[model samples]
Target: MGGQQSRQKHVALDDPESKYVIPQNTHKIKGLSRYMSAKADHDRIVATRGWDKHDENMQSMQMLKGLFKNLDPTVMKAVGDIRGDIQLSFKYDFKRQLLLIKVIRCRELPSKDWRSKMSDPYVMVRLLPDTNRQGEKKTRVVQQCNNPTYNEIFAFQLDELELMDMKLLVQVLDKDIISRDDVIGEVIIDMNTFKFKENPVHTAWYMLNKETDLSITGEIDITVAFQMPQSLFVTIHRATGLAARDEGNASDPFVKLTIPGTSVLYQTQVLKKTLNPEWEETFEFPIALEELEDRFIIFHVVDEDVSSSNDSLGQAIVDLKDFDPDRGMHGSYKLADLRNTERIRSKWFQRITAEEFSEALYAHSMSKQPSFIFQNQRTGKRVNCIVSS
Candidate 1:
């Protein structure tokens, strides 16, 4: 017999799903064997094409690697060199309850805009939560300089006991008038880490960081001083050029003297509705001689409020070094608003004279005596005798 004639079948290319509907069990061995062979051939072809395409891709990648390897090392280095963090310094005056932050300089600042080739940088400092709005402070912008030298000082009022809860935040930013300012980096300092008791004054350099990276942006130098004990005597004589805090009426002003480290506070009697008020009040404190170098006598002029908290008229901080124990300092000191340097009022402070101080001591001693008198035997005249042991 002649070889079995092969059967030819045709299926629509667009309607391939129609082939699956054919009775698969009825075809049995022959149909299943033919289907398996055809599937194997198709799979082999697909594998061969995929291999060839993969090889071509591998070759292309190797060529790209060789080209990149031939690039100049300096160009690669330039791409790797990015900007870093910044540094700051701080100084705390325990006696005045003042925290001073000094923006000394910033180094290795990356150029914010690649085309500009430089940055206009400034520093913004804030105590977190900036509740009073006055807690935020800033330094002047240095134009087009990557390494900027500010050497500017900003001050904050803080209690010595509350230093543990304080956190200082410093931000380095690139200034832009046309657009929003860009933040280069920032640092947060925990004031509690400092040992103020052991070393009353100390300086340290802190490395700045961005996120979790140890960036080499720059460093900051900080100095802190705790108040020591010292003897101080202050007299609030009078104030002039006082602004009226009350609406349409002159202020009822009084003077207050405070020692920040200690709970000692002294106040003068209030003077009613006067532009120029004379207090002539004297207050004294025994302080450590070593602490005198950092101590300041603060004079606060307040407008007495009957219904609410007293409003501050003005204030002045006098350095102890400015006063001489024997000669005493007597002059007019310009009064400024709290946390601000702009003068708002003028005030005169005069230390009591040696003769006056002696008289005061004598009077204080005599107040304890019930009855005492002295008679001059030679002149037959009576004189007052006050004695102290």
Candidate 2:
């Protein structure tokens, strides 16, 4: 298709970089001729700050201006927002198939550096059980963050994990610690679909009132484990009633558990309060299972005023099959042999009074040096305790 006949003496403009003689309606580069286009584009954001991105971020630190005592711990410590976004991801390899699980995001909402939006979530590790091998069982592992920072990211691999335990024990670290009540928010991802799960099972959170003088010291080993099918046990409160208040509006403060649109397992909203901080409780609920198709262990906080979300206090995704179930025993585990072993376990703790220990032992605080041993009637394990006045 060469110039067949110079049909109409055609002329074409070949100026690729030319900014001159631009059409009126088209983009005119009149001002562009004076400055470098690349520089001008990038400089738009810099012109206002007059500093590099890193420096701008540093300068943005506004000396943490708010009620210092009221804000969350992170802001109280003199740091601005989180250094970066928070992430939690892990994977399981079973029979050549890969199972990936991760938290999509845990961003702080726009309230006081997002402290109100902060969440203390439960983390677990599970190694898929081998069905072919009947004798072998699944293993579940549960873990709690010792010092959970905002948007804290975590990644780990459970080596040959389940044959014993594969679930994570996530114990929230804060001023108030409740088995199911500490939940303030959640960051969840679906196991099957690999999508973000909004309302998860056994969501947990905790809070410390500004007026309370409850003093906690050292690293109070927060533990997470499923003591039974419907109930999960959490141990926190090194010292609960520092203000010496009785069980009232400020005293009998308990973790109110309520699953959204579902019936509550705990018949009462008041579990235990500030009267005794050393006391611990287990919240039993018919939730979190593996073999079931209609999964629902998901829940939120109990609001006395409303029927809807009490701001959805945190979230958790739990698989009963992937957790180390605490059936209570001193002997080796084998569900069939549980009843037989219970006898031996009972004999061991027979000398120890369960009711007395449950009540009297609560007088001891973790902060003080131990003066007595509190044994579990079922497991026969002794808990070190100390009296604090």
Best by TM-score: 1
- Model 1's alpha-carbon lDDT is 0.56
TM-score of 2: 0.18
Please report the TM-score between candidate 1 and the true structure.
Answer: 0.34
Off by over 4 Å in 2: 1-251, 258-321, 324-389
Best by lDDT: 1
98: Cα error in model 1, Å:
0.5
lDDT of 2: 0.29
CA lDDT of each prediction against the hidden true structure: 0.56, 0.29
